[model samples]
Target: MARIRVLTALKIKRNLKPGMYADGLGLYLKVRPGNSKSWIFRYRTGGKLRDMGLGPFHTVSLAEAREKAEVCRVMRLKGLDPLNERLKEQQAKTIEAIETITFEKCAEGYIAAHKAGWKNGKHADQWTATLQTYVYPVFKDKPVAAIDDTLVLKVLQPIWRDKTETASRLRGRIERILDWARVMKYRAGENPARWKGHLDHLLPKRSKVAAIVHHPALPIDETPGFFQILRQEATVVARAFEFCILNATRTNEAMGMRWDEYDEQAQLWTVPGVRMKAGRDHRVPLAQRSQRILAQMQEIRTGQFVFPGGVQERPLSSMAFLMLLRRLERKDITAHGFRSTFRDWAAERTDFSNEVVEMALAHTISNKVEAAYRRGDLFDKRRQLAEAWAAFCAGTAPSKP
Candidate 1:
């Protein structure tokens, strides 16, 4: 063999230009102008010249570089391209691995895919707020695949007991995102956020958790008088609040109501699947008074929403309805509590069945066995019930069936 040309440390320090140099035995030095030095392997693959960076000199010593280079030489001799082989290995590790994806990246993708399908625009805002508050801080920098049960529990346990309803929803949302990650191969195995049989055994049931404080509601008898005063209160927000009570829907659902959702001909207003609380479509039988309110709203329907805010293309704020209630000197009542008023009134003052009343208010009936057996929405019976409710709210005697 010819005399060996070894690379001494002194020679590496002297030639510190940013390039690679052959130092016999397939080892080479990649020198940078800043005196930073790394090692590379020079080899021929199919009569082609190629270079592969091994690592920094500090991390990979001269001996180690030579050992790695010998492996590359053998691979080349066996007709394998070292660079192509290394790339293939890297690609394999990246596929379907949570270690490669960040929480922020997955969150953005989750929001994009599901935002439009949300029941209301505020649903999207709520999802973003929960992630920002709980999930983002913990996993923003972490790879999605690395998130485990312990990590998920850390974000959930703090609020799970105190804010059970919201916490339960947040848990479901978290499971959805992790499921998306798994489907995309950014994560693997069963979802860490699963609840039904998995997390259920670990955490207390949501119903067992302490209830959150809500604004106390006015008695049912006081609602019609409250509505009368609310009608005279001249503001888009006040009118929207009155409509919300009359329709017995949620504040956001009413304020976010669109002109297209109305059917003046059919005397119905159908909240689309994306906007209903149950994520199912709801049909509201439009009473004559509700139709009159819609007609009045048409005069101000300059935009898509019935109650457009001052800002362009924005719906009225949730607080706006509450403020109107306050201005009417009914601070004791809540916008959501009006639904309770309607439920009480329907139960006490009418002959409508519990299912009809529950479905009318878009409340999910919890009796799974009963729900599975019952296919019909009892729309006709509910229409008759709604007519009776309308008469009661309008200060008229109940209509004869």
Candidate 2:
């Protein structure tokens, strides 16, 4: 007869390494790297050896592991495989976890698991923000399995028409979160938040219901006049704005510009894919005015960013342009609208092809066939267009029609 209780609680704590230590009767303590320990039941069923995990050392005590091993020994005597029985027990626990998990809990888990793969920090933040602001208010503590179509509709209808774009994005985000829940086994049925074949029948199509509102832009003729005043402001943000307009780039792109990205001799500014909306590198051909702006910025250059913010060692705040606009009493127009202004001027004044103009603005072509056919960035044509645009913004008549 084998002696029972061969292992004591003190001995379990003393033996710590990266191999299995046997207690007796096929019960072993597996110690791994980082001092992590767990209990395992090692047995031979038929001709194969099977190792079944009990629980972690911190959770399952020596006494408990012995009791579980005794149970497994009895099952083996009855001609039952302990490994198969352990899997069945795990399945039961997984079912319990699925039933008890709340929608918010599942959402948090999903974000934590996937946010690292997102393009930028802002996108990850947007995922959490939308879910918390809109979805959480409705299903704060509800189990994901209990979420239904009516509850989802209740979250969307209030903002569906008034804040159409935000509401649409929110709906899509909720659908993704619910889909994740189903994949995680927290929910079993078809996603209630799904737009196609489900919510499509309930709410009006977004395109039909939501009114499209373009950002307010300066008229083609007014750009020169606005810049004349803007040039005299003598502020870092003002110069940043001028550089942004001259390059036909976004506010964040201009604010986040770095000195190393500029090639003085080549006269090009390469915006990295991380900072771009399309997640691809964009090469901006610097016009004379753009280079001049860089020359002016060189005198005050202090940190990594070409235009440093009010705080130390950070890029300029995105709101700097908007605040500057407000101070200039141009609340009607947005900094982003300058891109549209450039587009309008290019279409109205220049003989340049739409492709060249769109490329200058770094606009992604929505038509797949058109995008596939377009290979080059048309750098030379865009350079000509940029120089002409700079001239127009500086109150000079374009040399080309």
Candidate 3:
């Protein structure tokens, strides 16, 4: 019989020659010039013979190499190309590894890749915040490839109606991330967060599901007393809060107000279209008290924002007014509800036109016909109404402060 398994483990380890040594059954040891030893199976397929490397000698011992060589021998005997079979095995493993990528990893990748293109810097932060608050708690660690409609619904159903806008945004964001995963070959199939055809059937339309929520407003008759109490505090937030109520602006608009947006000469604060909810520039006519508050802020103006937060160079927190309410033992009310109170007062207490009052609140006119016809913001009339509002809050006749 021809020599088979002739090279012992000790001889294989000790031999440092740069040549191939046959060990029967087409299995041979390849010793490179650098003293690296590996196992190879010389086989004939079609008309030519070729060498296929099994593995390195250090990791695959003499016995292991023989076993792999025997398998390749059997494959060739069965008329299969061993090299092609190994390539297929490798590709399958690579796809399996890619499939193991997690949803959190994909989300982070998506945010990092697209945040630069977003106009607002806070957009990235909001994406991360919402994912952390909602999605991560549910299935962030699960494989991205495994995510489906059932898992997606679990994340949105609880907050769907309670936080309609946020839930809607989150669904869209998840859809985008899943799409990204598909493009990267991490996942495949229809996106579970897709709304129109897939999720629409499972869930109600956002508008139909979301009930219009009215913030708890203070009684119109008691605003003057509440204003008097708010005036007693000398904090920067208190002054900013007072300015907000005087203007009848939204919480975000007031809290994000910058000194640069104000024009002292005209007694007007022009909120840029970027800051306005309607995406149009809004001119707010500052009243006498509001002007006084501006003067006070100008004295201590440390940063760009009119209402500087505790942190340097940052605006006040959204919760500042709510916290202020808690401190004054008025937890029954909300800062946003003050806008409703202003609306009620304008209707019941003042003779101001609906157009002027709505303009003061910077509310988007839902009536398309009326909005089209109304051109001017009625700044002069709004100024008079603002002064009247201040007087009512002060429990004094409307006067120039």
User: Best-fitting candidate, measured by TM-score?
Assistant: 2
- Window of ten residues with lowest summed lDDT in model 1: 1-10
Candidate 3 has a TM-score of 0.62
- For residues 1-401, what per-residue lDDT tens digits would candidate 2 score against the true structure? 86556777887788477988888899998999887899999999889899989899999999999999999999999999988887898899998877888988888888888888776678878888888888898997898898999899999999998888998998888888888988876788888888889899999998888878888899999999999999999999999999999988988889999999999999999999888888899999999989988998888888888999989889889799999999999999999999999999999888988889889888899999998998899998889988999999999988673
lDDT of each: 0.81, 0.89, 0.90
Q: In model 3, what is the error at residue 358, expressed in angstroms?
A: 3.4
Clashes of 3: 0
What clash count goes with each model?
4, 0, 0
Candidate 3 local lDDT, 72-106, one digit each (tens):
98998899999999999999999889888899999
Error of 2 at 159 (Å): 2.2
Ten-residue stretch with the least lDDT total in model 2: 2-11
Clash pairs detected, candidate 3 = none
Rank by lDDT (best first): 3, 2, 1
